[model samples]
Every structure is written in C-alpha cells, then in structure tokens.
Target: MKKIIKTVICIAALISAVSCMNNTKTLLPNVSGKAGEVIIVVGKDNWEGNLGNEIGGLLARDCEYLPQREPLYSLVNLSPGAFSDMFKLHRNIVIFNIDSTVVKQGVVYRTDVWAHPQCVIQVNASCADSAIVVLEKNGENITGAIEQAERNRVIANTLLYEESKLGDVVAKMIGGRVHFPVGYNLKKVTDDFIWIADEKQYSTQGVFIYKYPATDEDPFSEENIIARRNVFLKEYVPATAENSYMTTSVFVKPGIKFLKYHNLDFVETRGLWEVYNDYMGGPFVSHSFYSKDGKDIIVLEAWVYAPKYDKRQYLRQTESLLYSFEWDEDGNDGK
Candidate 1:
C-alpha cells in the first residue's frame, strides 16, 4: 500500500511539472489588464440576483488602511457568451456557470488560460443555492489567490525598473538590502535613518528604513512600534508647516501582527498616518525585524500620499519593496 501511494505521488508530481511547462510555452500573451482588476463572467440573469451578491461580496470587499473605501478588486461583469479572446487575457478572472446540467458543484483554477501570468477561476453548480454554498466555503481562498497573483506581477514589474543605488546604500549601512525602482531617490539619510521617495506631480510614494539596538523583546510590541515610529518620522519626515511632522494617527490606532517572510521573522503594522499640525495624511505600512547579527532591530516602512486618487494600487506597489529585503549571508558585503 505504501508503494502504491508513493507511485501515485510521483505521477502527480510529473503531471504538475508538465502542466507548468505547457503553461510557460503557451502562445497566449501576458495579461493586459491593470492591477487590482478582475473580470467576472456570468449569465445576465444570475449576474443581478443572489449569485451576483455572493460573488461581489467576496471579491469586491473593501481594502484596509485606505482613507477612502475602495473595493479590493475592480470587478468587470462580463457575460459568459461574450467571453471572447480579449476578455480571457485578463490578469484575474472568474467564470460562474450556474445550470441544472452542471450536476454537482466544483471549482477549477487554471493558470495562463489565455495569457501568461494569469489566474482563471471557474465555478460550476447545478443550481444557484448550491453555488452560493460552495462560494461561501471557498471564497477566501479564491480571493487570496487572485491577490497573490497581482502581487507577484508587481514584483516582476519592479525588476524591470533600473536598480537604484539606494538599495545598495541600505545594504551597507543597515545590514540588509531592499530593491528600489529607478525613479526613487535618496530623500534623506542620517545616523540610523534612511528615507527614499518618488515624488510626482500629484502623488508621492516613500519608504523609510531605520535600525535600533534590540534592547529587549518588548521593542516588537505594537505600542512600542507606534511609539518608536512616531519618533523616527517626527525627526525625519517633516511637513511644509512649521513644527509639523508625520506621525501615526491614534484615532484609527494602527494594527500589528507577527509574521515570517523571506526567512525573517517580523512584526507588521498597518494604519493611517497624519501630519502633526497639517491636514496632509494617507496610509502607511511597516515591517519590523531583527538584523542577522541579532543585535539590532530593523524597520522597513512604505507610505503613500495620493490625495486625489484611490490608494490601493499605490500601496501595493510600494509594499512589494518590503518583500524584496535580503540579508547578506557571506558577510563580505551588504548588497
């Protein structure tokens, strides 16, 4: 029995490998849709009924930490009959097939169906009620997969941009490296603090990296993080007004969680940030972790200021930099 199980596992692995190869060789082009956009293919009848509500409620949920509420994904409702070659090339897609002929409910997730780097989710059910039940059971996982696909795309896009010396500088000074786009420039640098920003006409995107001695375990606490962040921002991120500086807002108190990513265990914080005496404010995210030597605590943060537009995409783009952190293992260099 054990031998049979092993053989089955090997066969499954072989099949998966072949599938991945085929997906790569696919003639379809890369996805053409924008980030945070999803195409939902459903019949017109069900598109406006309970079925629509379930799908929208799950995939179109609100994104957190944005000043204005925006759906997690910008959904495009397309009819199944109209799902031509054009629509199939979207980055994220969901097809809901509700018909009595579909005997049982099941979901099929296909990658690169009509484009490279794409995710296509198909839900089939014999009736509307059963479809709703299946969706409720698997909604979170489906949405998570879609979000991850976009994030991977963003990371890939970041690589296409020119590598900034800012990343190299950080590696040497802070004992870790974070990739930055070419447009980003070194805005401010001081003992134990580094600020990088890409300033545009109507928007500003920034990152803050700093380190402090790891005196105790309490430094990773939420309260301590907020306290320390305030000090760092106040000193480095001054506003236009006199004595005004950037600080985390207490009204919507920041949220923190412990997570492990890229082999580094860290605390993540998400919340709103406001100028101390000014009205300018937006969202900020941060990750706090320990250096390789275990003597210092490193904090890498990303924040955005786009008053006239939605911030979900901006936040995601900047957040990708935090995931790009790498530690130097050879000890010869930080880059």
Candidate 2:
C-alpha cells in the first residue's frame, strides 16, 4: 500500500509539471485592465442564472473601511464566445465551465496564462448546482487569491519605481524597510517617528512609521493600538487648521484582526481618520508588529485623503507598500 501511495504521488507530481509547462507561454503580453477590475467568462444562461448572482454577490461585496461604499472588485461579465484574445489579457479573470462531461468537478487556479502578472481561476462542474457548491466551499479562498494578485501587481510596480533613499532612511530608523514608490517623499523624520507622503494637487497618500517600547501586556489589543496611534498622530500629524491634528474617527470604531503574512505576525487595524478640529478625513489601514529584536512595537500605517475622487485604488496602492516591508539583515538597532 505504501509503494502504491508513493507511485500515485509521483504520478501527480509529473502531471502537475507537465501542466505547468503547457500553460507557460513565451513572450506573453502584459495584462490589460484598470485596477480593481475582474473579467468573468461564462455562458449567457449561466451568467443570468443563480451562478452569476452568487459570483457577483461574492465578488461585488462592499469594500471595508472605506468612507464611501465601493465594490470590492469591478466585475465585468463576458459570454464564452465573447471572451476573445483581447479579453484574455485582463489582469483578473474567472471562468465557469459547467457541462455534463466534466469528470473533475473542482476549481483550478492558474497565473499568467495569456499575459504576464495575471490571475485566472476556472471552476469546473458537472452542473450549475455543483458549481455553486464548489463556490460556497471556497468563496473566501477565491476572494483572497484575487486580492493577493491585485496587491502583487501594486508591489511589483512600486519596486520597479522605488525610492531607494527613502527605504534607506526607514532601514536606518527602524531596522526594516518598506519600498516606497517614485512619487512619495520623506515628509518628516525623527527619532521614533517617520512620515512619508505622495502629495498631489487633489489627493494625498501618506504613510507613518512609529515605534514604542514593547510591554508584557496585551499590546496588540485594538484599544491599546488605537490609543498609541492617536498619540502619535496628534503629535506628528497636523492639519492647516490651528491646533488641529489627525486622530481615529470615533464615528466608526476601528476594526482589528491578527494576520500572519510572509512569515511576519502582525495586528492589522482598519478605519477612518479625521482631523480633530478640521474637515480633512479619509480611510486608513495600519499594521502593528514587533521589531526584530522584540524590544519595540513598530506600527506602519497608510492613509488616504482624496475627497475629489474614489479612494479605493489610492488606499490600496498605499497599503500595498506596508506589505513590502522586510527586516534588514545587518544588525542595525535603528538607533
């Protein structure tokens, strides 16, 4: 039985290798589509039926922590016949294949099928009912996969046009670095706080990095993190109005979740920020984690101020910068 199991595993590995080779394309075109857009390929009947509704409801749910309501993804449906080569190059795609001849009734995820840096997820089922079952079981997984792809694209672009000088300053200040894009510049730098921003005429994307002494208490708790963040913002982040400073918006209580990504455990907070005596406000997301030496709790926060336009893409682009953080190998204590 053990020998049989080993043989089966080897066969599976060989099949996976062959499948990868077949899917890889040389000189693939770059993906086309606006950020936060996804193309869904399905039959007209299926798309108009319960399957389409399910997919739409899952993918089009309102994004969290935004001041204004915005769908998580801008979904575009295309019939199987309309999914031509032009549509195939979209950055995000979901294809539904419902047929009686489908022996493998499951979801298959592939990347860069027809274009570089693309996410293509195909759901195969013997019938429409079976397709819903598969989606219900893996809804969160599907959403997460697409979200990661979007973030990866932003990170890739940031790395390509990175501001290396700002990264060096962050490493020297915190013993870690986050890749800032070309437009962002250092706003302020101090012993324990660093501010960076990409200020445009109508919109502003900002990031704050601050550290405090670690304690044995529940440091990652929502209340504690908010209190600390408010303290930093009130001290460092100020508005044009007299004595006005940024603080957590009490109108919407911030939400906190612990997450482990890229081997780093951190507490994430999402909510809105407002100036104490001013009208300026927008959405913000922060990641609080310990320094490499575990001596300090470092908080990296990204906030957006875009009253004139939709903020979903702006917030996402700035938030992706926080995910690019990495600890420097050189033993700099960030002194």
Q: Estimate each model's TM-score.
A: 0.87, 0.91
- Misplaced by over 4 Å in model 2 are 1-25, 333-335
Structural RMSD, model 1: 7.5
- Model 1 CA deviation exceeding 4 Å by range: 1-24, 99-106
Q: Pick the candidate with the highest lDDT.
A: 2
lDDT of 2 by residue, 153-172 (tens): 99999999888888888889
lDDT of 1 at 97: 81
Q: Give the top-scoring candidate (TM-score).
A: 2
- Any idea what lDDT model 1 has? 0.87
Q: Please, what is the whole-model Cα lDDT of each candidate in the order they appear?
A: 0.87, 0.93
Worst 10 residues of 1 by lDDT: 326-335
